[model samples]
Each structure stands twice: as C-alpha cells, then as structure tokens.
Target: MALRVRVAPSKVVLQNLITCLILFYFVYYVSLSMCCLILQVYELDVLAPFDFKTNPSWLNTNYKVLLFSTEVTYFVCGLLFALVVEEWVWDYAISVTILHVAITSTVMLEFPLTSHWWAALGAGLISMICGGQTLAYCLFKDNFIYPDLGNF
Candidate 1:
C-alpha cells in the first residue's frame, strides 16, 4: 500500500509525486502570474478584467485573452488534482471557475477595479486549500504507512 490509496505501492507513490509537482510548481506559477493581472485590474479600476477590452468594433480582446488563459490553467490544475485523488468533482470545478470568472470579469467591467489585494489573498488561500490535500498525498508517499500501519 502507498500513502493515500493503501495499495499499489509503486504506482501510488509515483502518481503522488506527479500530483505534488503539478499542484505546487505548475499551478503555483500560473497563480503567481495572475496576481500581477489582478493588481493591474485593481489599480486601473477594472473589475471584470477578464472580458475583451477594446473599442466597440475593434475587438477589445485583451480581457478575453487573459480570462481564457487563466481559466485554462485553473481548470487543468483542478482536473489533474481530482483525477489523481480519484475525486472527480466536475461540478465543483465548473462552479469554482465560473463563479470566479464571472465575478471577477463582470465586476471589473462594470465597476471600478477597487478590489483590494486582500481579496486576491483569499483566492490564493482557496486555491491552496482546494489542492493541498492531493499535493500532500503525493509528497508524503515515500514516508508512508502500510496497511498494517507500518511505516516505511
């Protein structure tokens, strides 16, 4: 047994390692970059910063590009984490993304980008909490307890 699944010694450990890397490094990078975008939006008074920001006919495509890129990264991370832990919560993933995207984008578009950094911190915390369990599973696979409660 591995750390989390209580079986599949090698496979679970290997997968756990992958989960840690993806949840931490890959997702971490994307979220870090997003902080900058959030900062700019907040400064420029743009709440729905994820929509297209262009002239009426000239394709205000900046916001769309940002949302698409960020959403893809967020969705991928959520999907990978769920798959690794055998916790395929499709509804949860969609809800989180849709809620965040709609709220952030619409707010930025209609109102002033007055959201503070504290809100962004909350987002980061939520991200970590959502994915932290899977990440810990992967990282602690090597130092694991067997079915008999024996440590390796």
Candidate 2:
C-alpha cells in the first residue's frame, strides 16, 4: 500500500491563509456590530467576544442575547470562510479558531477556564467547520461527486 500527499507551494498556501484570516475577522466584527445594533445591546463591550468572564449569564436577558448573537456571528464567519477559501478548508478554519483562542487568552491575561466559555468556543469552532465544509461541499459538488474521466 502507498500513501500519496499533495503539497501546495508555500506562497500560495500562505496567501490563502492570509486571505481566510482577514475575511473571517472582517466578517465576524461586522456581524457583531450588526448584532449589537439589531439586538439593541449597545452596552455590550467590544471585548465581549474575547472576555471569558462574559459568558452567557442566563439570568441576565440582555447578556444572554448578546452571547447568543456572538455565536451566530461565528457560524456566519465560517460560512464566509467556505465561500472564499478553496483548498484545505478544514485546516484554515481550525487555524483561525486556534489563533482566535490564542489572541483571546493573550488579551485577557489568562486562559478561559469556565465551561460555558469553552462550550461557546467549541460550539463556534464546530459551527465554523461544519458550516464551512457543508457549504464547500455544496459549492464544489461536481468535483466531489463526479470523477474526472479525462484523466483516466
């Protein structure tokens, strides 16, 4: 048995990664702003996305809504990623999530310890990958579903 691997040129890989990261963050922040305005939660802090202490406190209705809205934005960010990136969709998506967590921990001066926070982050990661992959599959179904007979 033999295993085969395909490697893209470093320059092209880096370009795709940079494009994915930029597009993901840009769409995320824009959606966050829209969520704030639509939910009338202007008091929500800009750093809420990274703040571990900002977990969805169900007792506080506004805070809960704000957190939920943030999750939705994460899913949308994933969709945008799929629409933009063509190859290594999973790799780019996971990389973006790790970078987000790293930045969040750095800014907060500590890692997120709460289950709610982790759960939210996990949900966001899952949503991004699943949604992105699903959309990517749909968008590139021909490649996935049909073999290139020309090569054979």
Candidate 3:
C-alpha cells in the first residue's frame, strides 16, 4: 500500500495566493493614505489620542508634490501589482524604475521645496504598513493566510 495526499482544488489559486495578499496590502495602503490626508486637512485630530509624532524628514515635502507624488505612486503600484507573475518583463522593470525615481525626487525635494507635515504623516504611515507587509511575507512566505479566489 502507498500513502497519498489530497491536492488543492486549483493550482492557479495556490500559485497566486501570495500575489493576492500583496495586492490587498497595496489597496489598503492607498485607502488608508486617502483617509489620513482627508482627516489631516480638516484638522480633525484623528491621531490626537496617541499623538505619535512620526516626523521623518523624507516624508515632509511640497504640498502639491506630496499629494501628486503619493497619488501617482499609488497608481503605479496598482498597475505593477496587476503585472505580478512568475516572470517580469521589460515593462515592469521600467515602471519600477520610474516609481523609484518619482519617490526619490519628491523625498529629496522636501528641504528646498515647501513642506506639509500632514501629507508626510499619511505617506509615512503607508510606508510603515508596507514595511509590515514585507516583513510578514519574508517571515511566512507560502504559509501566510490567503483567501480563496474561486468563491469570488
């Protein structure tokens, strides 16, 4: 007699599970940033309870650039997430380069250009979220929780 193991219902779903989680994290990042920016603009003091001052110099930049760059970054990330797969081609490589340039230029422009702490706060929080997601992915790899895409 030979021992046997049951297989998953769908191989594609299993293969793309990690990618789906990454895409979800990216979506959550954009939504969270928008909410934070809205609250900060109205001076709602959403973070008043904790009053955590995460004033990283790189985040504070010209209001217009901060807003536009963050929005563009979100868009670019969404596009890139859609392109996730086993093999990345030239287009993905180029887009990644562009994203890096956009973020770097805007961050460096913080000192000479105008600065908005609120925008910085929103962007910084998103960065932290991304960092956490990255850490989780690194630690868990394929074992991390992933939803079943077949139901949807």
Candidate 1 yields a Cα-based lDDT of 0.46
**TM-scores of the models, in the order given:** 0.31, 0.78, 0.26
Residue 79 accuracy (lDDT) in model 3:
42
Q: How many residue pairs clash in each candidate?
A: 12, 0, 0
For model 3, residues 3-82, the per-residue Cα lDDT tens digits are: 99877746644445445445544653465466557545433233221122334344543233334444444444434443
For candidate 3, list the clashing residue pairs, or say none: none
Q: Is candidate 1 or candidate 3 better by lDDT?
A: 1
Residue 34, candidate 2: alpha-carbon lDDT: 74
lDDT of 3: 0.43
What lDDT does candidate 1 reach at residue 135?
54
Of 2 and 3, which scores higher on TM-score?
Answer: 2
Backbone clashes in model 2: 0
lDDT of each: 0.46, 0.74, 0.43
| Cα lDDT tens digits for candidate 1, 1-152 | 66774667677656665554446345534653565475443332232334333322225344433443344455456546555544423334434444555554665555324343233334543553466445545655664444765664
If the candidates were sorted by their lDDT against the true structure, best first, what order would they fall in?
2, 1, 3
